[model samples]
Target: MKAFFLDAAVTLTLTAAITTMAACVGPGAEAGTVTKGKIYASEAAMDAPLYLYENNHAEEGGKTFSRSRYSDPQGKALVEEEVIYEAGKLKQHTYVQHQTEERGTIDVNDGKVYYVFINAKGTKTGSDKWNDDMLLPDMLGQRIADNWELLNAGENLKVRFLALEVQDNFGFKIFKEGESTFQGKPVVDLAMKATGFFVALAAPSFKFAVEKEAPHRLLKMDGRL
Candidate 1:
């Protein structure tokens, strides 16, 4: 999240009810420019493989609305969607399944979940009240309760990885830190991690890269857990 037209973090929280927040990350990201096709790149976003290896970039700053073009296999102009990001939060769902289309190496809609950020445990961040949206069955939930690797026995923090329902190169690494609350009652922060394989699944052959490690990709988050 960069602070260009809007402070991504501040805007996100203020627009909490917007329901459509851009979730995005890059090595060194740029934005649309005033002059047609003008661009820039920061040193930091450039260093990360997520932005570097992708082999495409968008300029930061300048015109709020500008369009560039990247192509697809059938020579179609790819319409990239806006990445939804959050602040002081675990995961920012950039792509949602319900609304998405590619354009010029940019995603148009703000509903695509290519990646998820997790704490140490297996529970999802922020969202604690488990329900059908968790994509878990009675038996699977039992397995999670049984085999989860506990990082903090006191907080009941544990971790687990599972294959998805469709198995379409998509997965989430969870950081379950006991029970918390969202609207009310209790909930958990299941920060799911995704891989480049997911990118390709969403945008066939949509070249991308990801790095996994002790604390970078997989993390023991700074939470009560």
Candidate 2:
């Protein structure tokens, strides 16, 4: 597979991962034998679940999506993010809040990644090209590989695998706070500190819950940005 890196001039650091609620459905879904539009639980002991499989949206060559509304210190709508994916690849990602608005696409082929950025007005602004020498030659799959390596190296589970959408001059400090239950399933809690040059002096924090199984899906996530 082709291996590429961010151009040296681009010094931004960002990490990305899917955050969603897990719901088990379909026949034999409890045993991870998914059929049709269902998510099956895995019985295997997974250090980290495969990214390709974790994506409920990518499962059918269709779109899986989520959206969030951000609020200001005064509890007013400030920004919003609508994350979209198709067959495990990010098809369209949009973030509009405050004065910052961006829309972009992430594409990976044969180990090479192409990141194209467009402004809110729908004009191409910049693009990045890179390669990964790990896993399947796809963006989401490569992230799963990277995250597994980090987990094996004892990296904190709080720090999620980087996604192309969020890779721009930012630092993530993740803390594993404790354990909890989501939808009656066991989960681990992670607190994230997002800090970067473009971010304000007061960095925002977010919370995440990960399933305690092989795939370690994001059971639920809630935060105020």
Candidate 3:
């Protein structure tokens, strides 16, 4: 698939990967299946069985989506996240974490779709514009390949990636090494992360499953990784 890269002058780093060809939906990826990795909305193992899933969206071109942050695990939303889709896949996502005085309205200006900054003044940035998808060629497949290699290697060199529906094409190819129990249920060694944010978490190797029956815990989002 063809992709655009930010000039070296923008972030001063380089990484590459194989991307989806025109947002082709992978086999069996119609529902949400949150898993662990460099970045994603993963199902919590020990917490209140909180779960999140990335599901399939629109088809072809600029399609918009709405995400709601709620007080109930599956109820009335307290906050909303406006997301954009391209070729049936997620292109950009933005949500105001808090409505406190420390926050304000986040506006997407200058034709930019997705945005993020690794710096305080929002100096360092990334995008999800035309040919500017975060996961590059070979990066959005069964095995984590190319480009994102640095993300698993570099220290102090932080990265944020975006991933789509976690049904079959999106859930983890996780395997169980032995029988285990977490919260009185079967648990397995698992990793979780978001696909579209600038945060990486190694979630203390877990064995948790989604219990449409539980709630999600909020992680404190204002500290260094």
Candidate 4:
């Protein structure tokens, strides 16, 4: 599986597995799962997390839903995002930046993506063609899990990932970096970088560690959250 980071330079570290649910949904609905992770300033100093993230996932009516919240050390909300998917494809994503009061939404429809942003100034909107294989930040983990075999075989894969903040897509290449031990468990290391000329020079490469065993659960990600 392939892993992608959030911003051009930020870093994220997955300290736990997504299946390790921290909470559950209410009655009459499928049980929800919660995964929590920490955001670090850099990989070299993971001694403490600069921020914390929690993702809650649930399924209903053939569709999957996820809500993620990011907060500072004191628990002050920074950003909140919600994503919906159908059959493993993005359906909609909406987020709000509490500090800036910036809100946005990305919707996929009929091979196209529609985006809208609202802030102190006013509302801005745009659209872009949706590529069939385009990946979103929230989909990275699943994509990696789904393509584990190809990655394990040493295949370097190229993918187009949607950058919701810019309402555009960027090219990226994912390759196996090597094998290592993380948190005392054996893991397969993978790395990804921007493929575009200018992006390749400016964007820092990201790394991921996944279990070497079956299911290949993500152990850590060294890049922006």
Candidate 5:
């Protein structure tokens, strides 16, 4: 079966990255300045639309943590998450289910990346050594932004990340449906379809209500299949 877990690739991996090297904010230095907020999936039919929360450093602008939750068709609660760049070159990931957790930790050694995964019982389940194909979420946004030419030209853009070699990366132009209100603010209705390698078979279409501004932060997403 093509598992529902594949949806997580769209949810978490959208923000994937090899955690960047940066100095940890000191306690006396704007430590609690993390801005936190949640964005919801905008589809009306979805009673359990995807909900995501991100904690971003107010001073640094990069995400510190991101969590997303949605219910599968079988009514099982699922969450996929990432904790980034805590102190050293370490990042944490968790995939949650009704009773089990698939957890992973990523670390760098001699400029090579590897990850270790464990089950809910705290037993080491698997590990990948010198893995080159790990998906980094941080690059996904920039990948779309860097291809503004194609986006503007109304092209079906093929997105590629060197580190995510095995994933299917594709995006399509979403016509402006109209104007709408989201979170008490005005937004533009734009639609796009995206499929990562893991969820390529699903080929989900996403609707976005974006701030009609220069750096449009997504106001809402309709990520229903």
Candidate 6:
């Protein structure tokens, strides 16, 4: 299956992985910047959250570390993920699905991406060489930040993204959609779509709301996650 971070192309089960990755903060992590957010079914119907997530970020020994936990509305942990970055890029990621006891890890080494998953079915492993512009899910925000100017200038940004399920990389594009208000705050709307010929035909586009000012914090996202 094709996956582009928070894009709707991913299956519902993969949404858990997407949220786990997005909740990760980039390098220059701080200890007290923990934040919590709710995942709702839709923007208009916010009566209750389908799931709640918590993010804790920290810096240790020159590496940025992030831990994210997702829970049901009744407060039972569903999935938990830990991610580490070195020099502002993803180093390794591990996640656990509490209910199924399924666990997996993604590692980058010597220009290659490695994945290992364990479940009742058995242990599965896969690897593929990655390009310099290839991004792990946690790096999506930083990528957007790095290309902020181009996006604001109405330029389409293209990059490769790692799809953990397939243990492969796929091309995707990001561009500015327009400007709008989200949660009463001024924001810029951005859209992401798969760029590969076949994937593009089937993959659904995704939307994001980012703060208009400097730092350009992401205010909201609308996708399968």
Among all candidates shown, the one with the greatest TM-score:
6
| TM-score on alpha carbons, each prediction | 0.20, 0.41, 0.31, 0.81, 0.44, 0.83
Q: How far is candidate 6 from the true structure (C-alpha RMSD, Å)?
A: 5.8
Writing each residue's lDDT as its tens digit, candidate 3 over 106-217 gives 2233554333422233433344333333332112321222222332333221222343211011122222233344345442222333332322242212121211111211
The digit string of per-residue lDDT tens for model 4 on 1-225 reads 112222212122353211111111111123376666555555555676677777777888988888888788688998888878877678998889899998898899999999898889888888888886676666766677778889989998777876656667788888898999986889999988888987777656767787898657666765532
TM-score comparison, 1 vs 3, better candidate:
3
Best by lDDT: 6
Ranking by TM-score: 6, 4, 5, 2, 3, 1
Q: Tens digit of lDDT per residue, candidate 5, span 138-187?
A: 33333334444455455554532222222122333344566787657676
- Candidate 4 vs. true structure, TM-score: 0.81
Return whichever of 3 and 6 wins on lDDT.
Answer: 6
lDDT of 1 by residue, 1-225 (tens): 211111222121111000111222222223422111101122234332111001123333321222222233233433222322122111222222222221111121233223232223332312132222222111122223333444223233222221222222233333443444433423333333234465335423111011121111111111110
Model 6 C-alpha lDDT versus the unseen true structure: 0.70
**C-alpha lDDT (0 to 100) for residue 183 of candidate 4:** 69
Question: For model 1, what is the alpha-carbon lDDT of residue 221?
Answer: 18
Q: Could you tally the backbone clashes for each prediction?
A: 58, 9, 25, 6, 10, 0
In model 2, the Cα lDDT at residue 213 comes to 54
Q: Tell how far residue 90 is off in model 2, in angstroms.
A: 7.0
Whole-model Cα lDDT of every candidate shown, in order:
0.23, 0.38, 0.26, 0.67, 0.38, 0.70
Score residue 209 of candidate 6 by CA lDDT.
Answer: 78
CA deviation > 4 Å runs, candidate 2: 1-104, 108-122, 129-154, 157-169, 195-197, 200-203
Which segments of candidate 5 are over 4 A away from where they belong? 1-81, 85-99, 107-113, 120-146, 160-198
Tens digit per residue, CA lDDT, model 2, 1-225: 111111111111112222222121111112222211111122132233212112112223345453434343244544444445445444454555354655555454544445556656555433334322211112322243336445434465332222434442234555567778866778666665654544424446655565655455444444432
Could you tell me which residue pairs clash in candidate 4?
A: 1-144, 2-144, 10-224, 11-223, 11-224, 12-223
